[model samples]
Target: MHELIAAPFLEDFLLLRPGHASGVKIRGHHYLELRSLAAEEGPLPGWLCRAAHRRWGLDLDAHGSTREVVLVREPSPYGHGRASYEVNNGCNWACPHCVYGDKRHEGLPWPQRAKLLHTLRDAGVVWLELGGGECTIDPHFADTYAYAHDLGMMVEILTNGSTLDRPQLLGLFTGRRPYRITLSVYGATETTFDGFTQRRGAYRKFRRGLAAAREAGLPLSLSVVVTEANAHEAPAMRALAERYADRVREYTHMSPTFTGGSDPLAQQAPDYLHHRTPFTGCDAGHTSLNVNPFGLATVCKISRDHPIPLLREGVAGLTRLGGIADQALRRHSGCTDCALQQSCTTCMPLVTLYRKAGAPLDRYCQHA
Candidate 1:
């Protein structure tokens, strides 16, 4: 893995560390504007060296010059700088609140997966999030992650933290390091957690994984997921997460599945179902997208109506994405004439799911 990445981020250029979130935004031409700098083999430009030292306290000069630096020469044609990919739909735990109704342990083979990564890089994606039913358990997890990091994309992982404590995984993460590893906290106690996940010994594994990650000093974030099954232990869950992670987020709302299945909605805690803020607009298809394991690209995770077969057309398939996003974000037929349209907080794709599930109006609409 390259120690430093100098890549084009949208309209601006950035100097970023492999595992770190913060970066130095490159302004003015300096070394980056010079096309020859990318091809030349020598010490890194003095300006870049200085920027790295000032920003990350990195000694690029001592690191044996430009060969260690990964320089991106061209800008992205898709105009997208970030994306989230589901490496597989498989999970070790069967959580009731999972938005993906069906969990399948399947993904593209390594060869096709490599092609997808290159396509994402060529499309100018810098921040890539790898998720799944549990990405850590995927067969190609290690290779996919290392390849993405080598391709100059800062990788973030969303996982259940089950297999994180394994020696191989720990070694892999310790070596390459991810920009962030977000673990989903189901419950505080073994009974509550294992019961919630429908997997015995889940809580024990989670605790072990948490300890391993903290010991390794990996960048850690926690999502304290709140559902009816584990709502009673919410406080404990938050406390446990805070003990291990510096960054903790709470997820209270449970949405229907990506396929518009409402099975997961039954797990939503009534008290936690707060009103959503009005939907303004998003840059989902325009500036960001979501991809499934099969290389099907959609506007976002929820709006899966029009999926562009990325493997067939490659990045060119993304041309239809912006238009698809525009259509998917519009108000559904039921919501189109509603008087609360202005203050409605739920996006159209979500609203469509609620409508499909026959969800109570109060759950998503203002009038209810």
Candidate 2:
């Protein structure tokens, strides 16, 4: 915990709140309330030690103790250092459980896209996450990659891996990038994948893309979003992930329901009622901004109201606006309760899906 606190870049990038401090209060009421899990000099208190994990999203406890949810310093306002450009929402796959099917936003102007990249570069963003509805389909996809590379930032693409074979996709590297390609692979085989993604040739095409990415020397990782169609294949899927090496990761745990544009927690899982949230605080509103295609800084990726135009004013302006700005976010309970609070990304799309799925307990919760 001290190391993270001492790290120059992260310290500047994130604002860690001392437990119970009266510093900038985002939570309704605040005061130091936690006890250290260990002796101060012996080891970190449980809350502080397990504060840097990503597992809170899956309801998995990183702490050996199952007694605590994570908490984090409140997030720095987003769009300050770098902007998260959400290109569009329409995915090539029509996965049965997909919520964005009806809400995918599209058609971004090229200039706006150019300005977005330049803004991130000028801000000294160390990491730029290129995401979708489906990012590769963006008209300026090649230029976007080149621009990110030119800005000298490490990039990570959260893609479904459809058109990796396109000449445009290959042009992203141009021999000057330190990039990571992530595949939101629906499944491990054609039958399994098709059932989950609803994209007929996606599995094969994804493999082709993986081959291309490997040949390009770009690091690759597979992210399997566990759902009804793919849960049973966890073991086999995990084996496949190993083939991709240390980079492959399986993200099981239910997503918030997105159909009809509902919150994931509200709907709950058919037979589950367990709810898990990150233990850390978010840097979203301050440090990480999820920009809509139109360049609006949404309270969340799934938020449809109170759109703050990031390109127009930037993160500092959004901070002045104040609050989550989402009518749908019932409360920010998840962040307050998880142990891995500091390093969690509470993506709104997943929150919406989790709400709809009846908030079922995570099926294979790693903590369990």
The candidate maximizing TM-score is 1
Question: Best candidate, lDDT-wise?
Answer: 1
- TM-scores for all candidates? 0.96, 0.63
Give the Cα lDDT of each candidate: 0.86, 0.53
Q: Encode model 1's per-residue lDDT on 248-317: one tens digit a residue.
A: 9999988888787889889989998765677889989998999999999999998888799888999998
Backbone clash count, each prediction separately: 2, 62
Model 1 per-residue lDDT at 246: 85
The ten-residue window of minimal lDDT in model 2 covers: 18-27
In candidate 1, list every pair of residues with a backbone clash. 277-345, 278-345
Error of 1 at 246 (Å): 1.8
